[model samples]
Target: MFLKGKTALVTGSTSGIGLAYAKALAAEGANIVINGFGDADDIEAERKALETLNGAKAIYSDADLTKPEKIEEMMKQAADEFGGVDILINNAGTQHVDPVEEFPVEKWDLIIALNLSAAFHTTRLAVPYMKEKGWGRIIATASAHSKAASPFKTAYVTAKHGIAGFTKTIALELAQHGITANAISPGYVWTPLVENQIPDTMKARNMSREDVIEKVLLEGQPTKEFVTPEQVAAIALFLCRDEAAQVTGANWSVDGGWTAE
Candidate 1:
């Protein structure tokens, strides 16, 4: 329980990688603030479960992250409840698949606001608390798209690329504060969201299930495997360790060598 008494705030944490990040931190005894939209019952269940991970406190924040004022309120709640976030994981994101010409302008704005700008809001709000303590961890769930691009995903790609640069800049600024800022870039992570798309993809392309997964999905992943949420969370956990104090401004790739090409 190296993180006992610390607090972690994870955006988009109701499920998938975000939830995994929360669970990992909770296991190490960190108080938790989970943010995202989900079934109320499910969110509460997860929140209750987190508190039991190591007898730490856990709360839920349904803050609409695209709104800066809501982000501020959420941060204030964290401060009021647990002395502010010691670890901030900017993981809330959404995806829209379409050519740039056909992409909805509203979606482009939302992607930029949620995936990119929300990180800035959370980081800016949490930095003061961290600076006061002289210790903190900031991790962003950037994607393989952050390093390599794919067609029909202009907004997502743009936002992720922005995140890579944002992570680097903040890392340099916080380096002397005993804080580490890093981004984790994972490729084709296996989650309910990814799993749900498989059936549709298989039917659309007249491909077998295995073909959809291997050829269509894992095409760029040299290992031909879906990176698990736990794997990405492990890297986040490592970044919070005292040993990683100097490991800032890095884009840690858990992408099965997708960007190695």
Candidate 2:
């Protein structure tokens, strides 16, 4: 119960890595506010799953994080329900794939809004409450692309790089306020988004899934395996600990040595 009295807001938590983080925090006794843009029924189901976890109270706030106004409202809803946010996981994001020359302007804009600007919005809104309380943890789900890059994902790579810079600046500004801002960069995590991308990549290359995984995704990774959400969540939980007060403005990578080379 490291987070026994903390209230955590995990955006895009209805499924995937976000959901895993919510569960991990709940296991440590953090009250969870799950955020996602989805059907009400799906949201309710996710809320129920979180609630079923012992020592955790789960609530849902459906908001499209790409919109600033909606994100503000979601923060208010979380604060209202959970008292105040002690931990914020900025996990809501999307990716678009296209050659730079052919990339749609609208897609680029949407990627920035969701993956980068959403973090800015949430941090700005949550900072005041955190400052008032004298303690807070802000974790952004950046990507290995933040440091490296892959083809056909120009917008995602750009947004992730922006997030790294954003996290560092916020960490410096909020350090004196007992708030820590950091980013977790995961490589080849086997989430739904990644799974979807696998098929698309396969289609593009006219290769089998196995061939794509072995020749493409694992080509740069030393371990040649997907990093699990649990692994990433464990690091996230550690960053929220009182012991990690001095560990701000860092990008913790769970990349299976993808960036090591």
Candidate 3:
């Protein structure tokens, strides 16, 4: 295994795309630190399942991504437990859909802190170790909103756009250091987050659930199919390959042509 002795820290990884990333990495033989909130039993199950993959070690962190101190502590724990992080995926995020003027200030701040700034914190702490090791991968779960905007998602859009820029800056800064940085932008990912947003979207647009799913959620996606978490995970796996060493400083879109228009 190419990553037999490596370690990965993936935020928001108790479920969905983030979990997929963790599993994919563990399959390649990387120890995993899965972070997020969920039922204690369920989280423990996921953590145990990850450890089963290729017999990799796996741990769980309940760190609050919105808080820099906790993020630092989480990174320290990973470094202490696994020697240091070799793969860092900043995937924790949240969304609020009120109109720009009506968006709560607290919501905007929380979204920015979790979605964009958390990556900064993790990267800053993890980079020194990566630099010393002379290799690393930093991937962020940005969204199609990073490139194209939709109405009523001002905070999410802003945060994702910020991630795009941040990824590029990190890539350039580490270009000669054997470290790669990138963001994966997915559109209409079929996850609990999207499923849960349907009712709110229906209420906001005064439409039925079906209408919200088709006309609101899938409207921008020409494929009219939700991007699967596994599909995005495959791309993340590819980026860590030796063949992908030059693929940094890029925003890889798994949006099914949402931004092609």
lDDT (0 to 1) per candidate:
0.93, 0.89, 0.93
- Residue 85 shift from truth in candidate 3, angstroms: 0.7
Q: Say which candidate scores most in TM-score.
A: 3
lDDT of 3 by residue, 1-261 (tens): 678999999999999999999999999999999999999999999999988879999999999999999998999899889889989999998887877788899999999999999999999999999999999999999999999998888889999999999999999999999999999999999888788777767766789999998898899999999999999999999998889999999999999899999
Residue-pair clash count for candidate 3: 0
The residue-by-residue lDDT of candidate 1 on 1-261, one tens digit each, is 999999999999999999999999999999999999989999999999998889999999999999999999999999999988999999999877665787799989998999999999999999999999999999999999999997667888999999999999999999899888999999999876568666756655688989978887799999988999999999999999999988999999999989999
Candidate 2 residue-wise lDDT, 1-261, digit = tens: 878878999988988899999999998888999987667887788788776776588888888888899998988898888778899999988876667887899999998999999999998889889999999999999999999999888899999999999999999999899999999999988887787777767866688999888998888789989999999999999998889999999999899999888
**How much is 163 displaced in model 2, in angstroms?**
0.7
User: Which is superior by TM-score, 2 or 3?
Assistant: 3
> In angstroms, how far off is 72's CA in candidate 3?
0.9
Model 2: pairs clashing at backbone N, Cα or C within 3 Å: none
- What lDDT score goes with residue 2 in model 1? 97
**Candidate rank order under lDDT:** 1, 3, 2
Q: Once superposed on the true structure, which residue ranges of model 1 sit more than 4 Å away at CA?
A: 195-212
